[model samples]
Target: MKATELRHLLEAALPEAAHAEQSDLQLGHMYLPAGHIKAVALSRPVVVGDRGSGKSFWLKSLVDDTRRQLIGKTFQQEELLSCEVKTGFSPDVDGDYPTPKDLARLVQDGLSPDAIWYAVMVHLIVPESLPGNLVFWKDRISWIQEQSETVTAKLRAKNAELHAKKQCILIAFDGLDRLSPSWRDTVALVRGLLQTQLEFGRYSQLRTKAFIRPDMLASPEVRQFPDASKLLSLAVKLEWEAIDLYGLLWQYLANSSIPSQSAAFRKFADKVAKLSWDEGSNGVFVLTQAVRHDENRQEQLFHQIAGENLGRGKKSGNTWTWLPKHLSDAHGYTSPRSFLVALRFAAVDSNKRKFAGKEFALHTSSLKSGVSEASKVRRHELEENFPWIGDVLKPLKGLGLPARKQDVVIKWKKAETLSSLLAHHEPVPLPEAIKETDPASILAALEQLGLCRLLSDGRIDFPDIVRVDAGMTRKGGIPVR
Candidate 1:
């Protein structure tokens, strides 16, 4: 296919957003990362990921009946096929569980988060024989603790029943970040939920998956409890590599809405990367471990679309390497969401600018523009989760990257950045659960959110992923007016 034809195909091939859409999920188009099979195992209790990672997306997928089975089949986990998945926590409030409002109220009332979560799951498992007047969270938690033997007996019987039929009940928890506004409360809640998961470990068929952010998992407050190490042992990080991102791209391309678009890319994939993605019975393309892990093969596949390098001269960076590097955060992790958004925008730019004269479908300049757009989308995502980011980052817009750490700190002090974060985001949780209000503390929070990089030599640098959209400048970076 010519550059123009391929760009058109790309426009139809890629999804507009990085997050999992119900349409995409129902249509069986999710690119299950092979490397993440272990991280997403039903037995794993704690799932951790950084910002813009697909934690929320997976939370939704696992709770959705159809997609959950699809994940099981893709990962070849037999138990997941017949397993019953329950939503123990999420943004959407269910009648079975307490809302964030209820949890906040209950926490303030001195009810343990462990009791609340365990009660929530117990009610989900066996709703009968519970208090009819347990309309309040405190009352429900009190009931669970008071009737501990009754609840465990009921759970044990249910587990035995399910085990007989080759089924398991996996309670999936997510959105602990929104459990409470206070950092102390969030950690306590997270720790309690994790402790509850530990308590459920005795039963073979009773499992819990608590999807949490890495920072929450790392907090000393959360890991302070006894046997917390067991929960930590069950934890896994949903990290994506350059090749995995490419594999995800191919999954979308192979399952494009337009049949010919799908065929065109899959044909090229087979020809170039020696990749043959089989269409599983579940109506999605499946990738093998060999293709998923083969960096060289994946590079060849990507090079066909965007070419080998950004420039013709030997000194320029390779497009395959440069794309992810530009899209990666300071922690060296590339979110799949940002990855897809960059390519989709690049294709749009390629078509609009008539920049298809190059040998590849996407031109170098257009890819850079793609990174800019992706950065903007990523920042919007961060703002949704942490509203204070825009205010803190706004004053530093036009600041040069890789400057001395003291220099950035001085600017933050003059702008009163820490005070702004406090004064703003009234009910919203502090950015990345920051406890320290000092300028240095605020800067560290920014780094935790993957907004900036602290150099070994006391210099502070911004990764191109965020720097571009944050309006920060770096030497030889993409030009922005």
Candidate 2:
């Protein structure tokens, strides 16, 4: 096919239906049906997960559903209010670097309190009675800026008017790590006054729900709150179950109509679901679900699917292993953003094949030049087989490395070592890459500076994201010591 024609086909080939509308476009288009959104919103659960998991997508799903109500749609008032938080925090800030309360206040001063309150109230209180109260509040909006203690009480009291009309309110604080350096302080401030604020909103009728990362959950600052766990209505850890993942991938296949769904959808759909769930063997692929077997099915399945098996010509018998219960039990997927990242990476691998009968073909030779008859691959074994190699290949992506049509491939092709590649490591200037002193002295200096390391194999490696995604184009590359 012509280049333009091929590009168009690839774009058209994406699975749009698998994702919900109004979701982050990167998430393969997941749409939570209105009912699911309503249920999850009302649940007011504490969602936890890793760095790349899909927690953001889940929170966004709720936000999108709640936002829909303001546009004249008929959604349950209680349900609409279940996912809203009244906290003065802005969702726009990075979770790792959130704007401080005093700072947020200053930035928000230009916007009317009633406007912000309206969003908070609508998502955490009854909407039917809001119109008249909203108008009244708007008229008296200037009173919100007053410094008097009574003013804060008065605002809380007015919020109470809406609280009287509802049973509960849900306010979700997502993206904790995305905040400013004061992330721990921010969590402490929110938790310290949470009940008072809830009580303030109690007259306003609402509660707070925080979606957190595993690391954040263990913070003494947040743990110091005596009723922290109680205040959090439900604690859900989101890990990918084989079935959940299968459902996702199946939906993607159906939506993409790659070679038309009739070609491979039905046969693989049930099989994939069955294999993923493995009802016969108890596993905790989805963290929320109960185990089927007393054995630790979790690690077995995770190891099997995560590519923990084969790497660089060494095939361990344990390669086709399961996810250990300890891994899930430990991480809890409190922050789902990390999990989503892994899935998206997996999706990239799954879609590369043109199907033949029951098997799917993978393009590995495309990973390097002048190599033909690249290995045929399977989805079930990818994640388990080559965990580190998977990390390297995921960013390079497409037959492009081996062929063309690559994503981010051009940026990585020049490095002598994957670890030293510019895409994987920021290009240090000549002055920086080299030091006037001896190379050994430079290595010693870098070690002291915490800038670089020598791996056991005698190759240099940096201890960050940049080095993780880099690779060397040369064969039998040097190892760091």
Candidate 3:
């Protein structure tokens, strides 16, 4: 088949297989899908992630499964409905924007139109909107008390109606905390809605889950929520095991291979069926066995084959011996979701090259390329949407930091500094001799920025998906090139 056709086939096949439940454990993409189930069962759960981290995919799978159980087949649903609710912010702009009073009215309208809008304004906004007693707030508190009863009645009536319906109304609010000029006000508005409804038992059934990225949670605005931590438990992050990722890939491939339609697919499956990672304990490894066999037989055969390569019982020079030795340096696969993406790209390359029946081998270049692409996209998105990391890097590299006489003298030189690289969240750490400025402070700031994390007693490193440029290596570590 042509590369284009193979690419489509691999892309289609991989996700189905890797994303399957039974396959998830074996391929290392395991995750607690129970959290999602609990969220739906108990309260509205806000799910969040940086783009390309499979946020939509996870939710889609959950919803599809749920719908399948209900309707006896996966629902033909559009993802746009979820997308709109999640991402509802606009960048900052200068304007006499809507006030808390106006926003409160909007909520009142959404909740219960029976509440006299004027009464709501008097109860909620009057306290802060009086002619400056210079400090007019004190003067309007009395006015607020006067209208409270009328507004309260309306709100209660609305709550009663919602309760009578026996509906578990989940208002999933996603991406509102993303990059926006009005993000602060938007969050405050959401909090206000939660607080208001929380008081009434009738309104309690209508829960709202706001999905927000981790960095966004660091905002002082969010921190102001005394219950931030508690509320955050209702939030979900997409963390999957390596096995889960592999399962998803395998299932995806199995479905896409169209075994019933293609001789090539059957051949491919046969070759992969008996494929083994190493030799068996009896020491009989075969490099050319077909892989299209049944599951149990395939696993048994692979183990036997692997044990053979690794050597019988106590034999040395086994394939397993060399396998771990090679994998040790490449074990930074923190999440199955990321690893799955890299695997998909590799499968595309292999399938396109007509290597379906060939032995499984890691394509380092393709893996690195896929990871690099994904990381860059994620980083850009995180930075753009999450201002809560506000000036987190600024403490290290921005204009406010103190500059030395030598710094100014050599500032125009071609050399890069620890601070500069850190600002970009680059792979390698700054070398000691080169870090002349407040090195400790810069390092701490980088950690705060989540650009680098402490790995051991004192060693620091970037997250797994990010990598050092080819020629660069960790300080004092051997270079790969």
Q: Summarize candidate 2's per-residue lDDT along 306-328 as a digit string, tens digits.
A: 33332334442232221111112
| Model 1 C-alpha lDDT per residue in residues 1-481, reported as the tens digit of each score | 5667778877777767544222344344576776779766877888898765777678777777778777887789878878777888887525367787888899999998888888888888777858788777788788888888988899999889888988888888877888877767777888889888999998888888888888667767789999888779878899997877887787777887787867777777888789877777766776666676788888888888888878776568899899999999888889987888889889988776644345678888889998998888788877766678887788778888788877787887889877777767665557554655567777778887777877898888888877888888988898653
Q: Residue 21 of model 1: what lDDT?
A: 27
Off by over 4 Å in 3: 1-8, 12-32, 44-54, 57-165, 182-202, 226-230, 233-236, 254-337, 351-358, 361-365, 386-442, 445-450, 468-481
User: If the candidates were sorted by their lDDT against the true structure, best first, what order would they fall in?
Assistant: 1, 3, 2
Query: TM-score for all predictions?
Result: 0.90, 0.44, 0.51
State each model's C-alpha RMSD to the native.
2.9, 13.0, 13.0
Q: Which lDDT values do the candidates have, in the order given?
A: 0.79, 0.35, 0.37
At residue 131, what lDDT does model 2 achieve?
Answer: 36
Cα error, residue 11 of model 3, in Å, equals: 3.5
Model 2 TM-score relative to the real fold? 0.44
Answer with 1 or 3, whichever has the higher lDDT: 1
Q: Sorted on TM-score, highest at the top, how do the candidates line up?
A: 1, 3, 2
Prediction 1 TM-score vs. true = 0.90
Residue 34 in model 3: shift from native, Å? 3.9
The candidate with the higher lDDT, 2 or 3, is 3
